[model samples]
Target: MKICCILCDRYFTPDKMQIKKLRKHPHRIILCPECHERIAERVRKRKKLQSLKRHPEG
Candidate 1:
């Protein structure tokens, strides 16, 4: 079954293109490649913030 991206609401056929998981649900929803990259970057930034919160270091 095809799923629509949570961000852009773009319809995508799973059989046609690669669908990358943006984040683990309950927040997770399907995302297109561009959205996927953007989300991934956001996740990375959040992770960095988490790490910084845990330990304040250089």
Candidate 2:
């Protein structure tokens, strides 16, 4: 089925994916690979920075 990426507003087919939860969501919105990767990378960097702020790694 075709779903729109909530973040990038691009349409993509769910054939390339298999996330049942997202598929069943009310908006039926999904993230394209490129947008998902970019968001995940940002979140990873933010989490790493938060950890360093708390631990102060040398």
Candidate 3:
């Protein structure tokens, strides 16, 4: 079976991954943990940039 990447919306075979569930809806979907971590890291980075923009000294 191929697992879907929630971030890129691509399908990769199970043989090529470390699968994980989408935190918001864990039961209905699956993704490779690396992809999930990348997505989360991107979000975190974006949020940090936004916060920095809001508070220039911080």
Candidate 4:
């Protein structure tokens, strides 16, 4: 199925599993692979920063 990424607004074809999930939950937001990876990397960096702030190692 053709889906548009909410962030990038680019059209992409989702795989079978993604299609099934979207069908099951229409309210869910879809992101293209690139956008998804970008967001994931940002989250990982944020989490690492938070951990470092909580526990400092010298």
> Quick one: best TM-score, which candidate?
4
List TM-scores for all candidates, in order.
Answer: 0.52, 0.69, 0.52, 0.92
Note each model's CA RMSD in angstroms: 6.0, 2.5, 5.3, 0.8
Write down the TM-score for model 3: 0.52
How accurate locally, in lDDT, is each candidate? 0.71, 0.77, 0.69, 0.95
Q: Give residue 4's error in model 4 in angstroms.
A: 0.9
Residue range 1-58, candidate 1, lDDT tens digits: 5678778999767533343442223355557677888989999999999999999987
Preferred candidate (lDDT higher): 3 or 4: 4
Quick one: ranking by lDDT, best first?
4, 2, 1, 3
Mind giving the per-residue lDDT tens digits that candidate 3 earns over 1-58? 5667776788876542233333345576566667877889999999999999999992
Comparing 3 and 4 on TM-score, the stronger one: 4
Error of 4 at 40 (Å): 0.4
**Clash tally for model 1:** 0
Better of 1 and 2 by TM-score: 2
Q: In candidate 1, which residue pairs get closer than 3 Å at backbone N, Cα or C atoms, i.e. clash?
A: none
Q: Give the runs in model 1 whose Cα sits over 4 Å from its true position.
A: 1-4, 11-29
* C-alpha lDDT of residue 15 in model 1: 37
